[model samples]
Target: MDYGPVIDFHVHLPYRYKDPIAAADYLVKKLDEANVERAVVIAIEGGVESFKKRVNPKYVRNAVQEILDYVAHSPIRSIRTLIFEPDKGIDEHVQLLIEHRRRTEEVVKAVEKYPGRLYPVGSYNPDYGVDKVIERMRVYRDKLLGVKIYPTLHCISPSSSKLYKLYRFVEGINGLVIVHTGCDPGLWELPKMCRYARPKFVAEAAKKFPDIPFIIAHMGSYSAIMPGIYFREALQAYNVDNVWMDTSAVDPLFVERAVEEVGYDKILFGSDFPYLVGFTIEDSIRDILKLDISSDAKRAILHDNAERLLRMLGRL
Candidate 1:
């Protein structure tokens, strides 16, 4: 299956303790080996510790540094998405606010350095109240691709009224929103969080913002059995043009179902790299190439749709 020039719409740069530039080079090498033309590099702001501990300034600092290094050394065209983890519970409001501001500043600086390569995305926690969320959105409006919300991580429903303001802001800017749907195995201890990670909530938002593009990450396949649930919910929005889904570390079975339900034009190929653990970039691409879909559909999933997105954002 010749996919032509492929674009991985979802990927994360290495952010542990390794040298940032070397980690980027390693990632670019992998992309080159797999014939990937480009990828959307997202900063991983929330993870295991995000739920349990207070925001670590050092961790945020390191993440920003990695974003800078990765974009600076990327071997192919790359779009950078600055990740944000807004304050949720009442425990550390002041600290969380400070951390969000500092992180946003760092991201803005990186975008300034790389210009076209880096795009910021805002995040909101209902706990932050709509006013503050809108304020931050306004601050980054010029640089943002859109906003990313993790209902699972923030313990908020996707359709919660708390998010309407942000959605409207995004719509007003003609931006995009990427939501994390499906089951996140890493959040096993946080069962309540997983409960809200359904595609239905996203459908509600889609109805409200008909013009803004909303991407459902993982095609709603967070866990092994729940892919059906996620896929079913996503199918409900098949007629809604602004709603799209990504093939990020999902079962190939659901990937095929998504195409069958919504068509390849709505599906974007993503590797979920580094975080995909044992799987190589080739493993990710192979999942799509081996699918029993049309050659044209496969090509669209691998490259066309993502390129369309980039062109919409003026990144191309």
Candidate 2:
């Protein structure tokens, strides 16, 4: 199949255990090897740090140090989403906001340095109150491509009213929302929170903001687990125009089901790189090519959809 240009819609630039420049070079090398033209590079400071601490408090320092290292590195033209979590005690909440702001600034600087290569996305913990959430949104409004929310990681329901403000801002700016749906192996310690990552909540949000593009990352499946609850919900939202799904670290079987249910135009290919150890960019792209779908469908999933979306946000 001649899958034209490939675009990895999901990937991470973690600020730990690697030099940022080397990390960017490594990712670019993998993309080149896979024949991928572009990729969305998400910043993994705030969200992952919280989840890491939940798994083991010892991970906190390492997480912080890595992110700091990333900020000091040069920029690569990848989408940057600054993760934030406000669901904590007073002191902890304040500390998270401080760190999130600093990271946001770092991403902004990178975007400025790299020009068209980097796009920012804002994240907010709805529990922090709408006022604060809007305040954070304004800080990144001029520089962002959209916002990212982790309902499961923060233990907040996607349909909560608190998120509406952030959603409204994104819609007004013609931006997209990338929601973490499905279970994350890293968050295994909090299985209860994983339940909240279901795609149904995303469906509800999709219906409310019908015009805003919402990407359900991971396709609601985790680590080869078949027929995850998110898979069913994603199928349910198949008719919703703005609702889309990305195959990032998901099993191939689930990707087949997603293509079968929603068709190819709505699906996007993502590597979920760096975090999904052992899986190279080539591996991620190969997984899609190996599917039974046609050349046209594979083309859409591999590049067309993501390219269209990035163009919509003026990132292309």
Candidate 3:
């Protein structure tokens, strides 16, 4: 099962704790035991707490900084993503983007501290008007490697034309997108907003934005029977060309199906992480490795796909 050069394209670093490094240490141990080579750790604003209405942007920033500091000395490569709630509409949207820009500036000033291991990903609420957000992205295109969207929580369909420009912006910047898929966890604010969990919606986006690299998170909502249906359509529609799926927050059976149907080159390994602290990220990778997919396919899923993606975006 020696999956060399494995990479995790999805993971959330727990920041709400008193010590974020403690959490990173736990993750490093897991990665070592599981033989993971590189892991992308996205910053989470809140851990097991209400993040919708009561989230403090300052708190979110501090928590992320703590996690970054912790990962600085670790063996894992931690890619930092600035997270925000897009449902806040215009004013909050402007404020969040401004803050994100500032945070990115700070990271840039401090890049030498973390070196090549750290990179930034931007995000916005598509429902508010993807065009408006792309306007913001135009300002900081150089600092961002890609953007992340949670269509379900934003109550927006990925197929909206408003997002067309946003997708174009990503392509123009040579960036990728990570999307949340499937049913929302029972969080109060999340479930209310997470209506677009269906993979078909994302598939349509992938179809439309053929040049935009999209990663469907949580294996299309971990529907045992659904990914087969959704991915089949995705493959037929996009030939699995620009679309990708991640192992984050998904069931093992769905991962197997994604590899089988979409081919391993389109699947990125991820762990929702921190939210499920002490979670076996490697266990998920191991599950995918056990699948009957060829070693090359396994290699693609574990490492090659992500490497190509990072290369495409000039992040690697």
Query: What RMSD does each model have against the real structure?
Result: 11.1, 9.9, 11.5
Estimate the TM-score for candidate 2.
0.75
Which is the winner by TM-score between candidate 1 and candidate 3?
A: 1
> How much lDDT does candidate 1 score?
0.65
Rank order by TM-score, top first?
2, 1, 3
Clash pairs for candidate 3 = 152-194
lDDT per residue, candidate 1, 171-271, as tens digits? 77778888888765322212333667777788788888788888888877776423454667767755677788888988899888777866787889988
Worst 10 residues of 1 by lDDT: 77-86
lDDT, candidates in the order shown: 0.65, 0.65, 0.57
Candidate 2 off by > 4 Å: 1-3, 17-26, 45-102, 126-130, 186-191, 223-227
Weakest ten-residue segment in model 3 by summed lDDT:
43-52
Candidate 3, 46-148: lDDT as tens digits? 1112234443545445434554453234332111223333233323433432332222233233322333444445555533356666776677687566676
Candidate 1: which pairs clash?
183-222
Model 2 alpha-carbon miss at residue 290, Å: 0.9
